[model samples]
Target: MKIGIEAQRIFRANKHGMDFVVLETIRELQKIDQKNEYYIFVSPGEDKCLEESKNFHIIEINCPTYPLWEQIAFPRIVSKVKLDLLHCTSNTAPLYCKVPLILTLHDIIFLEPKQNDNKSWYQNMGRFYRRIIVPRILPHCKKIITVSYFERNRIQQTLQLPEEQIIAIYNGYSKHFKKIKEPREITSKYIQAKEYLFFLGNTDPKKNTPRTLKAYSLYLKYSDKKLPLLIADLKEDIINDILRKQKIEEIKPYLFYPGYIPNKDLPYLYNGAFAFLYTSLRESFGIPMLEAMACGTPVITSNTSAMPEIAGEGGILITPTSEEEIANIILELEKNSNFYQQQVAYGLQRVQNFSWKNTAQSLLNLYRQTVTS
Candidate 1:
């Protein structure tokens, strides 16, 4: 079988959930299967992360914008390759493609009602693009893939698609994420404190940054020992704006903004941190929660969406909206060493259920099935 994978943003310097998922799966597939030939379609990027294997081929497509790239240039390239089946790793796919299509619709967040809040132009544009493309491409796709069961149900109900058509394949964290010995060397370079709470945040509204900052402020007010927050991928200006809007300027003293931390150094950060906080409002799959667990770091995430399903009994679950609850969890974890250790143990055990090898095998099966059918 000749398989084509649309990993448009995989080569980009800053990779997110979907990009990493596709890349890791491809790498795993390379190791396991040499029977089928694979082609990875990507835009030009600085990071040449994936090496070309005997069965895998990397094709670079250049376009001015994402829409033109995916909608126009991508299909043209795939048509020439004569792929038996094409897997669109990202949520949106080309409206018109020659080969049988399998789409990994990570989340249908855009299909939900729009929030009347300030959002970046890039965020709004991407949402708008997905809104237009997803419906058009769904009927054309042979199978639909999602990251979590919660999202699978949501996509089925929202899109009114048959249950069997959409399959939930859980995402896996990289093996590189584990308890790092002598983590101070990594932490000392990024942050001032020897110990601090870690949170990965960005401009995305779903990240729930404003609420997290409010919760951290409450934690500082009540706890006897005030631990500084080490935030990654968040700009100082954005943090200040959120703090100002939430009227939690006092959190500035206990805040450490490291801007953006690379994926390679994340395990050390997780190992050195007192705890990892990921109380996002909604997520299809909380990859960070799994990464934290894999590193043997205690996590505090929201009970909503797929977070509970991912965290299970592994980490502390709290309501995303309740700043009080989030704050209390921090204090509780700090005060009780037994609970923290237990959470870490549970997480380490739970993480064993997921791996890139499993994900790759499932996808490989899907590709063969799609081609044969």
Candidate 2:
């Protein structure tokens, strides 16, 4: 089978959840499947991470914007390639696809009620675009893949999709995100603090940054250690604004905002962190939670959405709005060595269940089944 994959943003220097999912899956597919020919469709980028192989090819399509790129260039390219199947890795696909289309709708968050306004114009626009495009394209897709069963039910009920047409395939963390020995070597490059709390923050309202900060402030008032917080992907100005709004200006001194941290250096940060905070208001599947767990770090995430299912026995699930619970858990992990070690063991064991190889194998099966049917 000749398969075409729309991985538009994988080549970009800065990648997020969906990009990494496709990138890691493609890399694994390259290793596992030698029988099928594969073509990865992407925009030209500085990263140049994916390479051409005997049966695999990289096709770069240049466009000024995402809409023009997907809605315009993608259809033309798919026609030229005459692909047996085209898997749109991102949420939205070309409205007019020629062949069997399988879409990996990571989540249907766009269809849900809007909460706080987004900080970035691009994010707000992206949300708007998905709200318009996703509904129109779903009927055209032969199969729909979502990241978690929680999202699968939402997609099926919210969109009124047929049960067989959509299925849940869990996302996997990279093998590189493992326990690091002598992690101080890399952690020191980002922050001077030897021990700290790690939280991956962004402008998206669902990230629940303000509440996390509020909880951290409460932790500071009680905890004797007073460990500093290391936040990535958030600017100082934004952090200051959130701190001001939450009325916790004291945490400003305790925070080290590095703006953005590259994926390569994340393992060290996770390894050195006293504990990882992922108390988000919502998530389809929390990849960072698994990444932290793989590093043998205990994760504290919200009980809602797909978090609890993904975290399993490993995570300390607390209500995102409960500052007292989050703060107390942080203090408990620090003061009690036995509990911390037990959580660490559970995390390591739970992490063993997920891998990119498994994700790729399932995806490859879906491609073949769709094409053959």
Candidate 3:
């Protein structure tokens, strides 16, 4: 079977969730099915990750990604590729690709009414498109793929699509995420992180950054503990200003804003953190939760979305609105070392279930089914 994958987001000119997912999925697909040929359709400025694969070929569609480009030009490229099936990992696939289409809608956070990081207009526009436009286009596809059962259900209900059409493909942590030898010098550089709680993800509304900060503030109120609160850096300057405004003298020193920690350095951060805090309101699949757990770090995340399914019995689940409740859980984890160790053990055990190899195999089957049907 010959499949075409919309690979415009691969490596993304910068490392991010969509980039990681696309890169890892393609690499795993190459390992799993050597016979099936894949045409990765990358955008003008995008780079290919499958250069070494014999069965994988790069089809450079030198066009922009959105608006007029996607609506007007992408369908022509799909027909030109002579693809049996096309898998779109990005949101809003071409309105009418020539072949059968399979789309991966990571999350419907954009569908919600709220906005964060001053992206109100973009989010509102996307929400409108997802509700009004996607339904008409989706029925033209053979199947749909989502990162979690939560997102699968959301897609089905929102689009009024069939349950069977949406397949839940659980996200997997990279093998490189496992605990590695920490360089003594690197460890010494961030000595302040000894008892810090690490928060990943960009500081956006969907990520629930304000709620996380509120919870951290509550944690400081009653506890004698002075553990630092380390926030991963944001790409937006406005977000930085917002973060700085929240930084009062009491918690200012505890706030570590390390900008764009490389993937190589993340495992060490995970291993070193007191507990990984994931306060996101929604996630198609919480990859950071998986990464932290795989690294044998204890976790605390909201009970909603795919968090409960990912965290299993490993982490503490708190209500996002309750700052006091979030703080109490942090206190519990800190005060009772036994509880912390237990959470770590459970996290490591739960993380054993996800594998990129299995995810890719299922995807391969879907491609073959679309082609042979």
Candidate 4:
């Protein structure tokens, strides 16, 4: 069978959750399946991360815009390929796709209320695009894949889709995420601190950066140990604005905002960190927590969303809205050595259940089932 997978943004330099999901899953599929012909479609990008194997083809489509790439150029190319199935690894897919469509809707956060009025032109445009495209394309989808059961339920209830139409498949972190022997060599490029709390924050409101900063402030105010906070992917100016609004400017000196930490250096950052803060207000799946856990770092994540389910019996869970709850957990982890060690162990064990191989195998099985049935 011929399969066409839309891995449009995976080749981009700064990859996010969905990009890695497509990249890792395809890599695993290449390892496991050699019989079927696989066509991996992507826009022209500088990072040519994925290579073409005998059965697997990396087709780079040159288009100026995402809409044009997917809407205009994509269909023209795939229409000629005569694919048995087409899997779009992102939330939006071509409305006029001819073959059986499989869409990985990571989350319906854009469809949810009180969303971040993101100032980013690219992000807001993407959200608007999803809002317009998702409802139209969902009905045509043969199978809809989501990152977690929580998100699956949301898609069902909110979108009014049948349960069988949507299925939950967990995402996995990279194997490179495990504990580093010595992280300082790589981490020194970002910060000189021997130990610090690592938070991956952005201007996105769901990341709950303002409240997390407030919680860190409380930790510094109350606790004797005032370990500095190192935040990644967030600009210095934006962070200062958030801190200023939260009235936690006192914590500025303790902040290490190098901004936009390279994805390659993430494991090193996790290895050198005292703890990983992943207290997002909502997440379909919290892969960063697993990444931190896999790195032998204790993750302080929110009790909400799929985090508790994914956290699997370990790591610190706090009420995302409560800064005091977040602050107390941070302090406790620092004060109690035994508890911290136990968390590290729990993280390592929890990660065993998730892997890119598992995700790819599930997808491969789904592909066969859909094409046969």
* Clash number by candidate, in order: 0, 0, 0, 0
lDDT for each residue of candidate 1 in 1-373, tens digit (9 for 90 to 100): 9999999998999887788999999999999999999999999999999999888999999999999999899999999999999999989888888799999999998988754464689888999999999999999889999988999999999889988899989888899999888888888888878888999998888888889999999999888889999999888899999999899997797898988788988999999898999989899998888899988889999999898988885568899899999999999999999998999999999898899899999998888888888
Q: Of 1 and 2, which scores higher on TM-score?
A: 2
TM-score for all predictions? 0.98, 0.99, 0.90, 0.98
lDDT of 2 by residue, 254-316 (tens): 999887788999999999999999989999999999899999999999999999999995569
Lowest lDDT sum, 10 consecutive residues, model 2, at: 110-119
Residue 92 CA displacement from its true place in model 4, Å: 0.5
What C-alpha lDDT do the candidate models reach, one value each?
Answer: 0.90, 0.92, 0.76, 0.91
lDDT of 4: 0.91
- Evaluated at residue 230, the lDDT of candidate 2 is 95
* lDDT by residue (tens digit), candidate 3, 269-289: 888888899887877788888
> How many backbone overlaps does candidate 2 show?
0
lDDT: worst 10-residue window of model 1 = 111-120
lDDT of 4 by residue, 1-373 (tens): 9999999998899888889999999999999999999999999889989999999999889999999999999999999999999999899999897889999999988887755557777778888899999999999999999998888898899989989999998898899998898999998988888999999998888999989999999999888878999999999889878888898888899999888777899999999999999999999998898899899999999898888889875557899999999999989998999999999899899889999999999999999999998
Which has the better lDDT: candidate 1, or candidate 4?
4
